[model samples]
Target chain A: MDVLINLSLNGLATGMLIFLLAAGLTLIFGLMDVLNFAHGGLFAWGAYSGIWIYTATGSFLVGIIGAILTGMLLGILTERWIIKPVYGNHVQQILITLGLMLVLSEMLKVVWGPNQISASTPSYLSGSWEVGGVIIIKYRVFIIAVGLAVFLAVQYVLKKTKIGLVVRAGVMNKEMVQSLGINIQKVFMLVFMIGAGMAALGGMLLGPYSGVIHADMGMEFAILAFIVVVIGGMGSFSGSVMAAILVGLSGSFMAYYVPDLALAANMLLMAVVLIFRPQGLFGAKG
Target chain B: MTRILSNRMNILYLMIAAFLAVLPFVYDSRSLLILLSQVFIFAVLAMSYDILLGYTGIVSFGHAMFFGIGAYTVGVFMKRFEPETSYFLLAVVVTIVLTAVVSYIVGLLTLRLKSHFYAMLTLAFAGLFLVLAEKWRTVTYGNDGFTFRVPEFLRDRTDFYLICLASMVVVFILLKRFTNSPLGKVLQAIRENEQRTESLGYSVLQYKIIASVVSGVLAGIAGILYAVSLRFVNTSVFTMDITLDALLMTIIGGVGTLVGAIIGAGIIEFSHHWLTELAKVHWIFERWIIFFGIIYILVVMFFPMGIVGSLKKLKFSRKKKDSVPVKSETVSQGD
Candidate 1:
């Protein structure tokens, strides 16, 4: 029972991490119809920057801001330089973004040695809370709480704000949104920045949760994020959140029960969904 | 004049092949041999990728699935070999058959999906195999993979290269045949106009399945060579990088052109060999990948058609000074 609880917490923590990374991915793809393979690179940078700040200043809150800012900056750069020109052409977008992914990955190594760095939980988060003979790690709870908070905050913004309406309208039809006399470029910039911010936030939390931060983690996690985007329907923020949790819960459970099938299970689910409904769970029809 | 030119092109091909055949003499023999074998294997993989990407206008990111199938099939065969089985022949037939079957099954499941969904799903399949290779460690040897100690009949470079060369040549001829055949025409037809082909009472799914099966078999052959050449088979060969490499080679050499695969493979393998040597510093390989990515982006954006493809276009345009410009016809201008 204790191990189960531990694993469950672990799974939720991981799921939250995935949701953070994937939320931006889902939104970017949903609105832009652009497949940004380089999104992971931003996530990695976020972790690196956040952790670097955390270690230097010994302030977790500052690290989070640092990570989010780093991601937003990178997002602006990529959106302005790489993604802007190749907006419509997928092949070009794929090529440029893939190139960006490589650049970001390489840049990480240049700044930080190629070796993996072990990141620690904040001093306050290092301990555990024991209740009813079960010890729950405080950090995991912190991650879960932060993840839910972000989710709720994003939902609040998306549902209530004028910017959210514009984002939705753009996803429906970029031209139509433009025709409405709103500066679509401004919206793109805003969305791109926000997406980058989310990815960074994901990276910051994932750093301590995994206990090891590496340049390559972004690519691996990006693959999962992409899978979530595909499963949840690209652009459907809610869809990505739900799918990320599903993937997270299932992966955790499977790892415990049938370790051999754990990795394949998510992929199997994707295959089944893709084969049966190419639009994804909540994907809009083409 | 046309016949004479054709003869010259043929001779040029023969000379290039002869030069490649003897390249090991000048370079480090062991490294050159390994590179040569890799070039051939990737050439086959690239060719198979071209069948889906260049010819069919479908960019499949998960082609490594078939390549992995080929590798895993041979590994399975050797692992559970019968006492009397001929390791060489048995491995070849089994890998091809099994890979073809797997491709056929995959085709049935995925052929209906549009480009993006199918592409993502195929990528998922590639990841699936990698996960399986590591997860199902018992049969697959998981991350460690398995080793196939060659039977006494074939051990040296000369013998192995001969098998590789013969297989490649045969597959080449087979692909040539496929491109000229009625089925190939139908596949191209589907690529050009799916509705038109459907209206003509043809089944796009059937054609795609057959092509995938054929491509899978060829990839399987290459996989066997890959294993036998390295004297190793691991899950790493099934990773996204391998798929990316194959895709890179296919795109670089010029998609859809029959001979482009070999050129792409040879150049890339040579580049990799040299780069690996140069990338002694830890961050060098990552930089090299970034450089390649830059080149990839440029090539895809400006020269959308690949090296050989653009050259072919140049030649065709030159042949007829005005020949009704072909670019406007093929390159879609707008949605």
Candidate 2:
């Protein structure tokens, strides 16, 4: 029971990190019909920039803010310059974004040097607590809490705010939203920025969680995020969280029980999901 | 069919192949021979990709899986068995069969999905293959990989170079013929409009599977040649870099044009060679991928249609200005 609880906690934490990345990816895909492969680059930049700031300022909160800002700034630039030209063409988008992904990764090496950097948990968030022989890591708990808080906050905005409604409506039909006199381009930029920020936030938190961040980690996690997006339904927000948890827990349990099958497990899950529900779990029927 | 055979382009292709076939005999430059051989190998790979991406409008991120299968099959066979011509032939047969089966299965499973979904799923499947290769240590030798001896004739650099060159030419001709057939036209129709093709009584899924299998088998052959060139196999064959290299080659050369793929492969391989050479002169050049990435983005933005494709468009437009407007449509259709 203890081991099970611990595994679930670990899985939930990992799921939350993935959720951050997937949330942005889904939103960007939904509203703009643009699949930004360079989203992973934003995530990696977040880790590198956030960790650097955190180390300098001696504050994790500041690090998180720095990472988000960096992500948003990079997001704006990517959307404005790189993605704007290849907006309608899926082939061009994939090729261009993939090119950007490579550029971003290589630029990281240029800026931060071609070596993995180790990160430590903040002083306040370090260590664990035990109750009734069940030990819970504080950082894991903190991650879950942050994930839930972000999910709820976004949900509220999407449901209650005027901009949120516009965003939701935009997802349904961009042309219709545009016909209603809304500036859909601005909304796209906003969503892209927000999405990039969230991905960076995920990367920032992932630094301490994994204890090491590398240039290639973006691609690795980006693949996981893509799997989650595919399984969750491309445009469904709530579906992403659910799918992420499923992927994380399956990955955690499989790693423990079937060591050899651990890596294959999530891929298998994605294949199964694709075979059965091609539109994804919560996606509207085409 | 005879028109295609007697086309000026065909003569050009023949002349170029003839020139290349004889050049190595006189050149005696081992580096140039090796470099050209690598270009031929990648050209084959890129052309296979072109069949799917340009002709069929499919963008797959998992092409390296087939490439890796071909490479590993040869590597393992050469490692275990006597390095004889018969065993090498056996490995080649096995690679073709395995790649066809795998590509068919993968196409069946994922072709029904939308473009993005299909791309992501293929990538996941490739990742599965990579993991399998990594974990299956005894057979694969894990990430460290293994080197093996080749057949006696292949031991000579010149013989291997000629083999690679011949294979490239054969694959190119076969693919050119295949793309011009009625079946190839159906595949192109599917690429242009899947729904319309389906409404026209074609089984869209079946056509896609055929393309996938052909592309996969050819990619596998490229992999075999690649592994033979190095006489070694590693997990790197399955990496996303290999797939991206093929993608870049196809896009930079020309998407739907077989000739473009060859040109793209040559340009990319040569640039890679030149960039690495420059790395010795300048420390900054050590990180040449930054330049590669920049070039990729610039190509997509500026030359969206690629070198041959852009040139074709330019010529067509100029001819449009010179000739009657009605003739422009016919000329464009010829492309």
Candidate 3:
């Protein structure tokens, strides 16, 4: 029973990190109809930048803020320069973003050097707590809490705030929102920035959890995030969270019980979901 | 099919072929022949990719899987069985049949999904194969790929070059014929509008599956030739990099044009060769990938229709201007 609880907690933490990355991706895909292959690059950049700041300043909070800021700056540049010209052309978007993904990944090697950097959990977030026979890691709990807080905050903003409402309205019907006189393009840029920040936050958090950060880590995790997006339904925020948890739990259990099949398990889950519900679990029907 | 190449184009092709046939005698540079042979192999691979992306409007991210299947079949078979000429034939046959079957299954599962969904699933599946290759170390020898000796005849560079060139030509002609068939017309209709094609009573999925099998089989053949050229096969054959290379070649050459694949492959291969040579000269050139990425971005931005497509458009415009009154009809149809 304690093992089950421990595994569930681990799975939950992993799911939350994926949710953070996928949340932004799903929204960006939904609102803009652009597949940003370079989104993973931003995640990797966040990891490197945030870790650099953390090691330099010795403050995790400052490091997190730095990563988010870096993501926003990069996000603005990507939207205006890379993504702007390729809008409405899926093939061009795929090709250009793929090229950008390569650039962002390779540029990391140039900037930070081609080696994996080790990261440590901050003093405040280090250690574990024992409850009866079960031990809960503090960092895992912290991650889960942060994920929940972000989710609630995003939900509140999206449901109750004007900007969030406009973004949602645009996702539902871009032309209708434009007819209502909202600057859809500006909103897209803003949402993109926000999404990048979230992905960076996920990256920053994952650095400490994984104990090492590498440039290529972004692509690997981005694949998982894409799967989560597809499983949860493209453009659905809550769906991303639910599907992420499912992926996380399955991955956790499969790794422990059947290590050989662990990676294939996720793809299998996705295939089953795709076969049964092509639009995804929470996706809107076209 | 007749519309694909004009009499002038045929003459141009014949001249190029004649040049290629005699160039080895003129140059006799072993290194250059090897480089050109690599380009020819990739040209075949890129053309196969075009059959799906350019002609059928299906953008797959798992093409390297089929390529890998072809390579690994030869790699593993040679390692286990006797490395005889007959085994080579058997391996090539197996690659085609295996790739056709695998592609059919993959297409059945994935072709029904929307664009991005299909792309993601294909990537996921390919990644699965990569993992399998990595983990099944006994057969694949894990990351350190096993190298095997080819037949005595193939060890000669000239023989290898001629074989690669012959394979490229044969594959090109066959694919051209296939793409010009009535089935190819239906695939194009589906690309233009899937719903309209379906409404026209064509089985969209069936046509897509057929396209996938042809592309996969061709990609497998390319992979086999590539492996034979190298006399080695590794997990790298299944990498996303190879698939991206094929995609870039198809796009750079001209998506729907068969000859464009050859041009695109030559440009990419030659650039890579020169860029690496240039890298030795300057520190800035060391990061050739950045320049490559910039090139891709620029091409997508300025020349999305690609070199061949743009040239064809230019030719059409000139023809329209030459023929009075026909200009008005063509101008309105431009979009």
User: How much DockQ does model 3 earn?
Assistant: 0.65
Candidate 1 lDDT, tens digit per residue, B45-161? Answer: 888887876666665667777777777766676667741237667767777777877778777777776555556666667777788788777778889888866655447776666
Ranking by DockQ: 2, 3, 1
Q: Chain A of candidate 2 scores what in TM-score?
A: 0.98
Q: What lDDT score goes with residue B2 in model 3? A: 67
Query: What lDDT score belongs to each candidate, Candidate 1 first?
Result: 0.78, 0.91, 0.87
Instruction: Please list the Cα RMSD from the true structure of every candidate, rounded to 1 decimal place.
Output: 3.4, 2.2, 2.4
DockQ of 1: 0.47
Top-lDDT candidate index: 2
The candidate with the higher lDDT, 1 or 3, is 3
lDDT measured at residue A32 in model 2 versus the true structure, 0 to 100: 85
Query: For model 2, how does the per-residue alpha-carbon lDDT over A13-115 read when each residue is reduced to its tens digit?
Result: 9999999999999999999888788989999999999999999999999999999999999999999999998788887788799889989998998898899
For model 2 chain A, the run of ten residues with the poorest summed lDDT: A277-286
Q: Cα deviation in Å at residue B95, candidate 1?
A: 1.9
How many residue pairs clash in all the candidates, one count each?
1, 0, 0
Instruction: Using lDDT, rank the candidates from best to worst.
Output: 2, 3, 1
Name every residue pair that clashes in candidate 2.
none
